[model samples]
Target: MPDISHDFVDECFEPSTARAASADRRMHTELAASLHHLAEAVQTTDGKLSDSLGDFASNINAGRFVRPSVFRHYFQLVTSLSSGDIDATKALISKMNATPPRNAHRTITHFGHPDADQISLELISDGMRLAPISDTLAQDFGTLLEAGFDLMQNALPELYGEITAIVHEILLGGAPHGDSVEFDGASHYQFWGLLILNPKHHNTPLEIVEVLAHEASHSLLFGLTVDEPLVLNPNEDLFASPLRQDLRPMDGIYHATYVSARMCWAMETLAASGHLSVTDHETALKAAQADRDNYKKGLSVIDAHGELSATGQRILDKTRAWMNRR
Candidate 1:
């Protein structure tokens, strides 16, 4: 068992939820941290476990002494990931009505009672894949991520499918999926993981995709950098600009900069290729106009560094070329 941190009790949960002694025991742990633990736990080489939801539930329930407020706070945090009034994240997840991953071979488990809000979901196959905590009582983050991908793959089948192909080419140099280096980003095609951020803070799937693409792009550049701790006041120093400034100073620089740029670049590049409709391209253009500082800074970083990969340069050049043509 991993050591639970004291700061987690203080920093992770809301007061009402944290202090409630009779609260749902399964809901009391730090969810983000728990997800991390789930990711690690499911990776064990032990053959005794093939991934049963009931077994996971019994195991976690065994550890239950925490409050339900933790679950509430976790939802509150995830809900804030995107910026909007509609619970788009939840809506997106519901749309998928998710199935177990195609390659995943597992059983489902609730964290407390069989009737309790299902928390940890175990995917047991040749290996174990556990997804801890759901946005709703029925599904957890893994289910949500699968749903999001399904939504994207279906809604913009031609577009996202192509982007996925592009990401694959960049990361694998046209190699087959399982043959490539392991991916451990917020959302990766391998392992089938996607970090579902709150809709209120992010607002759109495109925005989320932008962040995901940045992480994907980083895999093409240098290998993923050792992530830094979140510094609440990273911008306290004037050097924290996503452009010109070194993104390495922040917790998720690739998401903060490169993936965001790659997303924009990909949208614009698609338009340039005449695959995206003019109106859609115009929408992408309008967004760039609306966030001129971010657009300009992203371009500036590419130009200043001359540091992007050939694929990265193609994305940057294509985006800029599209801007000029517009």
Candidate 2:
């Protein structure tokens, strides 16, 4: 009995010290550095740290937070799996700020129509892993890199060459900021990695190349290694539609003319390369054309009151050209 008691005590003592040391090691190296880097990056995007944690919570709920270090460890795990995204975050905050706590579970989600999916910020860390996508994709990316380009250093590509370069960098490192973008579709912005639409969805390398070029165009226009600071703080409405109270009043109308036009140019480029089918091109083209009225109105208002830089004018011109062509 005496020997057994002593063995148990020794076993507990040794492991406790080892565990403590392991924890300390992580704190000193990876954890601390990553946290600091994240803090810095957030400052770059949001312009201040006074409400960073709160902003982080908002981004987390909106499926907007995408820091790589946060992804690599429990730091990201807690935020991604535990919080709601933008919509949920707003509702949660509204409820919490209302005066009393509700009876909802600690893990909460938003509900919509029956057919629509109710998003869950539950157990996200369980499945997300960053690993090799495919040897073929990697090889293509490498070839682009060997051609003397760095995704982080250049403007977004007008062609496939630049897109390939950007994708390689994203695979090797990660996005310039957050992990992904959730604008109706789940695409990663230059905010994280350089990704276009999924290749599997389209089933052709040419199409993949075209999508890559389109997204890369954003990377160039926005920023190579980091997303530009928002001209105005964006919220749920902006995400859903650029036409929102917060959007600039173009003759008292908030619209997404510029974005629609740019996307048209990109898709048109893809169609021209035979990367998109005529059907797909037509679909995308119609969408762009639909925005023409909005664009014309917005441009009129902007020209009246807002200034357009040389580069901005060029982007709009190219997009319009792409849309106008058959």
Candidate 3:
């Protein structure tokens, strides 16, 4: 069996110097562009909510948006850039501050129906403004998430610590129809350390854990690679994704494979713990096996099409070693 130690996990997770440098450059460029855009937008409206502002907010809330946290960061950047002269920018900051908290609609509800003492967080009408899930259903969804976190704490304490340290906020929203869980913690959200999760699709603790692990891994990698490119190849080359039917960029493939490896690790930990119910244990084992298969498929694509720099290669090599260890 492969050595599955906390040290091994840390080694695999560490970013290379090249990656760090690349990420730093990318961040500098992005920050400059973001500040410029905010300046333009603020000037246009004199700091008030212009049509563009409304549209931007609407687009973000509608799904398929870049990091909303960027808006928050831009608020400060704009304030600094304006030298306190932009009242509109100040108003924008105030408005954002006054916006409803992410969990404003949370309430306690019974897990199932009438008599279950098990309680869960529910999001009512107020939450509907951001997500489609009803208050009652949100409770069950939140419960599953809590349970998943508990499992991670118990079975994968190292991962739990890493995630808690890296991920500062969890933003709940509605998933697109047919999808149970969604994650958006890519490079765009790296500045704010936020994870956007749509919980309506997860029905079990295992499912919740899988998505959490997958997304959190992405966030961790984003932090690691913020200063470097994962692969040197142009993103024009599309390849099959083991996690989805649609073709994806090599970077996406790397992310999928890496996260799949993490998922496999988590599931294996759960399966071996013998702490789960019989059904859950079986499910975890099956999921672990499937993730292993997917990891291999993704690895083949990476080997064939990926053009990793030295740093990227080091990261991929570590992940490959972990996947192939057993």
CA error at residue 187 for candidate 3, angstroms: 8.9
RMSD of each: 18.8, 20.2, 10.6
Model 3, span 198-283: residue lDDT tens = 66556777777777778877766665554467887788889999987788999889888888888898888878886689999999
Report the C-alpha displacement of residue 124, candidate 2, in angstroms: 10
Q: Please, what is the TM-score per model? A: 0.34, 0.33, 0.64
CA lDDT of every candidate: 0.35, 0.34, 0.59
lDDT of 3: 0.59
| Residue pairs in clash, model 2 | 61-84, 61-85, 61-86, 62-85, 62-86, 63-85, 66-179, 156-220, 175-192, 175-193
Best by lDDT: 3
lDDT of 1 by residue, 1-326 (tens): 33222232222111122212212221322333443443345346322221332233344445633222223323443453235423543342232223221122122223333422222221122132322223353244335444445544544444354334223211110112343332233322222221222222233344444444444444322211112211333433322345333444332332344444545554554345543456756765665554445656544543553344333343345445544554
User: Total clashing residue pairs per candidate?
Assistant: 19, 10, 10
Q: Give the Å shift of residue 267 in candidate 3.
A: 0.7
